[model samples]
Target: MDRPRRCVLLKFGELALKGRNRPRFVNALERNLRRMTADLGPIEVRHRGGVFIVSGDMPQEELAERCLGLPGVSVVQPALRCERDATAAADAAVELLRELPGHTFAVRATRRDKRFALRSIELARLLGDAVRVRLGLDVDLSNPDLELFVEVDHKELLVSVERLRGAGGLPVGTSGRALVLLSGGLDSPVAAYRMMKRGLRCDFVHFSGRPFTSPESIYKAYALVGRLDRFQGDSRLYVVTFGPAQRRLATAGAGRLQVLSQRRLMVRVAAALGERLDAGALVTGDSLGQVASQTLPNLAVVEEAAQLPLLRPLIDRDKSEIVDAARALGTYDISILPDEDCCQLFTSKPASTRGHPDDLRRIERTADIEELVEQLAESAELFHPTLEERAMVSAATPASRGPSLG
Candidate 1:
């Protein structure tokens, strides 16, 4: 009549491959897990061999689900923990497996604690026999209808029947930080997500066509960042009103180079903001040849204005691939909503696919680029997409100090 205690088990993926720096990776993963689940009250993560046993007052499945989205975690299993005795383990396994649908099962046991009374094979046999006798199930080693795993640690044994896949990568904060040029579009959100999966924690900067356009784009960008915040907490979004700058570029008679010039100026503003925040790089959603401004030569022209490394995570991906990723990431619906993006403004002619950097420099000289960058950076409004202190995102900068068209 003994019932097993509920717990959660976590397994690593690439972190296990780190030979000498394994401890650092493991510690980071553990720390991230603890911080992610801190709202569930006091929780303890016990490292046993390659698995982490998480025990708390909350439901085991809930804990497992939360850990599934975290980076560096490969598998999450809602498990039952019992004393290190064959009878206890067998009872736990049977009780847990009763809810699962299967005619055949296999008990895979790992004895990390050598001091345990039974060997791994013996424990598996014992547990399998108990299931066969009590539950009337057959055993199939190679391809079983169900799988029951028993992990023997120094203090206890964990029995689980379900293994859930997790977000497999290095933990966030391990790769360093970057600023994402998040637009209210499908591709940029996916780009941010890809970078997050690669261990880069990101803040966001959005260019909005305010004073000349509606605030719809700002809402979409905020919502997109809010969705992405679930993967990495502490996300901030900076809004820079870019209508006036776009107008300046247009009136300067840089007709064919309008889009490229706007992109360059946007990067310049992002780079300036990134420098003040100590970010090492800037992330963009530019896929190669997706649009005129994203073409090879045009992209190079835009890159000329950035002070930091401009990372395009979606450079080689197709639009279909990017859309699929966005749908899977839960950002597609928000991104598809109607919005007036800054780039959509002031384009009277087709963008030049092969923009020369010298032409862009001449166009930029018509305006006080440094003063405009300073005003854009200083007047930028900040938003906390994930935290509780989030405020309403203002579309326009302060009237007294707003950057204007030259």
Candidate 2:
């Protein structure tokens, strides 16, 4: 006889707290799940009460595994559906326990179908007796080696032995959007991930020093976004040519102020693009005092150029903490690859602490900030990696040995 097909059950965490906007967030989560799992095969996704049930030809375990990365999902269980009868529910619980390896077990059962004669406690006791008689396993409610979970809803009872933890947060796109200034470095990608965890769907804006510098940064940004795509589905990358703008800033001969001027221009350009994309904010990976351009007064001076909120997710984190998070997110290896960042080009001595707004104004006199931002926006190259491109990136070699620009 063929084994009964199983389905994965998903429960929402913070998303459940939403009052009137609950359906919107739930719909967003459903869309993301469908898009991420479309390649697995044909699947059926249904939401009942507060739980989502996914039934399809795809292996239930694999589906549960894939759902671990989805935000708004709190728990995943591979459950077998059975008729909502005490005997059938107990039999299904025994079948699940037979496959699981454990001598000490506990049955946590919930009876939602009021029409069923057995109460919650009665159903748990019945299931426990069945396990004890059929399999001879001792019950330890406090600390069990394995736990069999049963949920009786409407006309069916769902039974499972294993429950997996999910990535818990508000669904992406439930919050407003942001434009992330993604550099080919460890911090920016981590910043992007943090913002996504907060429910902000992010589009990337990368400034590369092509022609004047290697094309390594562009490829690195692509690889970085590819990893992030797993979380937010698809991402759009705006690559702006920054070499000409760097030269313009250097022409001012403001010495240490060149870095500050360059940052101001970058933020200005990012804000402009952010408005174009209708992003509510701009994100960066700036950590306090990590670099010469990130000083308190320097950050203040640079932020004056933008009209929108500049969100620095890593502002308070130390480099070590940021690196640890990067490694965990699987972007550390790619970010550590050799690449010439535009910010590192053409500058030797940068301001150690801060630069005065008076000195900045003096330097601003030499270059047309408006023209530079407009030029960057005009020459920007937009990249939206196809699903195939993302898959290729996932299977390809590490970025260090990966393909380079011709």
lDDT of each: 0.84, 0.83
Candidate 1 per-residue lDDT over residues 149-258, each given as its tens digit: 99888888889998999888888877889999998899999988888877888999998888888777777777788788877787889999888988888888778888
lDDT of 2 by residue, 310-371 (tens): 99989999999999999978789878878787886667574646888888777777787787
Q: How close is candidate 2 to the true structure, as a TM-score?
A: 0.91
User: In candidate 1, what residue range of length 10 has the lowest lDDT sum?
Assistant: 397-406
User: Which residues of candidate 2, in runs, are more than 4 Å off?
Assistant: 1-4, 391-406
TM-score to native of every candidate shown: 0.90, 0.91
Error of 1 at 151 (Å): 1.0
Q: Where is model 2 poorest over a 10-residue stretch in terms of lDDT?
A: 394-403
Q: Native-vs-model 1 lDDT?
A: 0.84
